[model samples]
Target chain A: MAVNESLRVLRTIHYDEHHYSLFVSAGTIGPKTKPGHFAMIQAGEGFRPYLRRAFSIADVTKVAGVPALEFVVKIVGVGTAALARFAEGTPLPVLGPLGVPFPIDDLLPSDRVALVAGGIGLAPLVLLARTLAARGIAADLFYGGRNENDVLKRADFERFLGPHRCRYATDDGSLGRRGRVTELFTNALAGGVRYRRVYACGPVAMFRALAELLAEAKLEGSFAMESEMACGFGVCLGCVVPMVDGRFATICKEGPCVSPAQIDWARL
Target chain B: MTVDLSTAFGRLRLKNPIGTASGTFGYGLEFAHYLDLAALGAISVKGLSFRPCHGNPPPRICETDAGMLNAIGLQNVGVDAFLAEKLPELARLGATVIANVWGDTEDDYVAVVERIGSDRRVAAIEVNVSCPNVVKGGMIFGNNPEALAALVKRIRAATGHPLVVKLSPNVTDIVACAHAAVDAGADALSLINTLVGLAIDLERREPKIGFTTGGLSGPAIRPVALRMVWEVRKAIPKIPIFGMGGIETVEHVVEFLIAGANAVQIGTANFRDPSLASRLVGELAAWCEDHGVARVSDLVDTLRTRPRPDHEFA
Candidate 1:
């Protein structure tokens, strides 16, 4: 069996106070990875620290056509903090473009695709927004950040969806919508807004709220959610969802992104 | 070029060095999309017991610094149900299948292991000694040297299959447990099952996960796991050891090998990517071939503890 080489970490740079990103050239993954997929990254040059951390594939922009992958990471704890300090030009041992990718191509022309993101959760949405732009899908994005700077990867969100459609909600109302982004989203839905497929990635609470809102609006949607993953692959039952259809399923193999209805939303 | 990941556990030789953890991999079928059941060194299915368990309720996990924690109380489909449901399918998967058995009492443990060992489908048995010994009035067997040793001996006499004792890191001295198990006729040891941990919720003034306390695993636990593996490896150099905690990649396998683990099991890594093993299997070969290394095993213990140019170790 031909095993792919562990991905080499191309560079590590800080994006904000509690956020950073790693660019890796892993042969095992896609040159243009789809949104909703993630990778299990092992940092620290040695195995003294044994576990691999899972991160969302925030942006899939190919670097010079070689198809390097980058993660939009939040330094929630120690592993990530160590990850941020990794020197540039070092190779990261990347494991995958695991889990289900967002259905970017599934968006309809007439469908108004609304991408909802919370805090650093905007990473994947930014890439999805760009794909939506390239597909010329009429869409908009609603983002909620604690403050203005916590908002992530806006360049693509603006460039792809047009600046007018992006709305923001900060606790202090530092930017656009003066409250929760979901509040703005709820307003949009209350105002007779229509979208073909609503794509969302954010806090579990945010994802739940959106699912509830989407249901209230009688709309179809998918969610890119996070689970505490040990393996970015499917074996570990650690990251799982109690499906509505019965039986527990792995998030990595079955999906990081699943139909909103398929999720045991009540469980979340 | 594929490296032989198999190593002997007394009479049984695992096909590869990679296996699954008791709690993390569940019953092992969830990965049908990404796993080739036969390719692994062995499959350590989820922890099973005499009765079905609901597991601790949700909020059962949360993200920590580099790792995560879970208190999934050996929730399983009861041993009889597992045999009836999962075994036939696993039989077809064709690799050595090791059942990780857990129970509240010595009789319970003996019974479960005996039942599993009788089946031709099961190649071996792993005793989950890390849990509290319900019969000994609740002190965990893994934390005490004599308790662990005696348990291993009891289980060994109960089953003919290769006996493996999974160790817990919650104790102050893991080496003692490792040593005791070997002395009691254990064929191998798989270890560093999550460190004891707790996560608090500021809002409700409550704790995260269904249980107030859970096992911590993931990237964060790697350092501790490596240290424990190194400690036990240094103390008992001859005994076969299967290392785990947060193993997620080919490099992790290499790390475990270097730290004295004969093989490594990908625990938390299985949660996010299903094809990680297949990919890592491929990656390890390429890494070996690229380095002009004749065998992947050559990388074991070869890494020097050179200080990284930057970053704080403590």
Candidate 2:
């Protein structure tokens, strides 16, 4: 069941000038929330920034032995800026544990999954990495950003998945590889890596390219989709992605996590 | 003394005046997880057609000033699926369901109503003639009084259920459309459907919404909605009006009640707070009690405007 509660801001960890991680007292929504599940947060005080901002519940952790939920946010507009600046203990109205989470039940401990993320897209993958770590499952993380500053929480992923398992790329060559993360993914596939299962979360442009790559490689996996939406629940029908079967699926309902093959990336 | 929040719009009596606007509420069951479905005065499900619609392309909605623009093209599960799946669940939930009907042609509307009107679970049929996204029959009939009257007459002949004609605000004189619908046998009216609007993306040099234009709804249009409700009430004193536009609080609801709406539908605000309508029901009762209102219905159309000298008009 989904929940609507006034959760207190527990902590804010700034990774850089624009990127940060927000930890909040989970109330009843923390324990049940999975990696890809998201919450529609009333970020700021009033009606100025009218709609609730949707954020993936990055991690379910603890603060001083109390359960808390972490949301990784980037300063995009007024709503997010206000969220980043909120002092600890401020009450935030959140409706949550929404949408289908990443499917991990079928995977065996020996199966290695390829996890890809770009920019703030790393939020959900962090939790996925942690979940895999706990399950004795192994995976690789391919992260990309516009610049080194945009590359967030490197040490955290390293700590969770080991330093050798994480690869980084930057658009301006200020980080690991000198190009888009998709290029790094391409290089990995070209070097005889038979990745049959891949999980990804990024902007639409990145997804368009990744869809082609996934289809070409005959690989199957889930992608956490994003769209501008008024409600994180299904009712708004605003956050929709075109499906291959000529239907529109509300990303809030059918996903945040859907099979890459189900999306009609050309139309998207 | 506890204020009686029950209200009557024509023959349909509601537990309160707070209803979810069609489109914003989906099929009503979608919100069951977050709020009590039975607490709402009524649930106006999304606009239904004869066949399931895929709606428009991507970027269907974007936030503007105090509201958002949407060009969803009246997407729905069609009438048959609604009858087979949705209506039964809503009935089980004990929700007063208002099926909002839409179509590409006049017969399409009639067919949908014919399928749903006899369900007994459906409390009313809200005929959607004002959706701004579709290419045909929606705002087309809504903009022309003759067409709107003719369409309403046909639907009136089809069913005995309480019929509400939802009006478009994208017209020269809204009172004319209001009269046309009421005169053609509409038992009640819902105004004003989203105003047609456009927003452009500066970086891409293209429309933000795929449809290029979308219906603007939210607190941004509240004043215009209030004025239209007042004008329509003045034009047809007896017809029931379901007033809506960016209503988020009890005060906004009371403003509509005083402005002549017998009831109010909470629209876009539902996106921000899913439980707002249920909360408003209790809030409205409390507000009425605090204002010494014995019956919530007693506050309807109770606005007092200053009497102006004849020379002002001259």
Which candidate leads the pack in TM-score?
2
What is the C-alpha lDDT profile of model 2 across A80-106, one tens digit per residue?
A: 888998898999999899999999988
Question: Candidate 1: what lDDT?
Answer: 0.74
Per-residue lDDT, model 1, residue B42, is 76
Model 2, residue A120: C-alpha shift (Å): 1.2
TM-score of chain B of each: 0.90, 0.98
Q: Write the per-residue lDDT of candidate 2 for residues B154-264, one digit (tens) a residue.
A: 999998999999999999999999999999999999999999999998989999999999999999999999999999998899998899998989999999999999999
Task: Report the lDDT tens digits of candidate 1 across residue range A160-228.
Answer: 898899888998878876778899898888788778888888888888888888887888888887776
TM-score of each: 0.70, 0.98
In angstroms, give how far residue B263 of model 2 lies from its true place.
0.9
Q: How accurate locally, in lDDT, is each candidate?
A: 0.74, 0.91
DockQ of each: 0.16, 0.82
What is the C-alpha local distance difference test score of candidate 2?
A: 0.91
Query: Could you tell me the fnat of model 1?
Result: 0.29
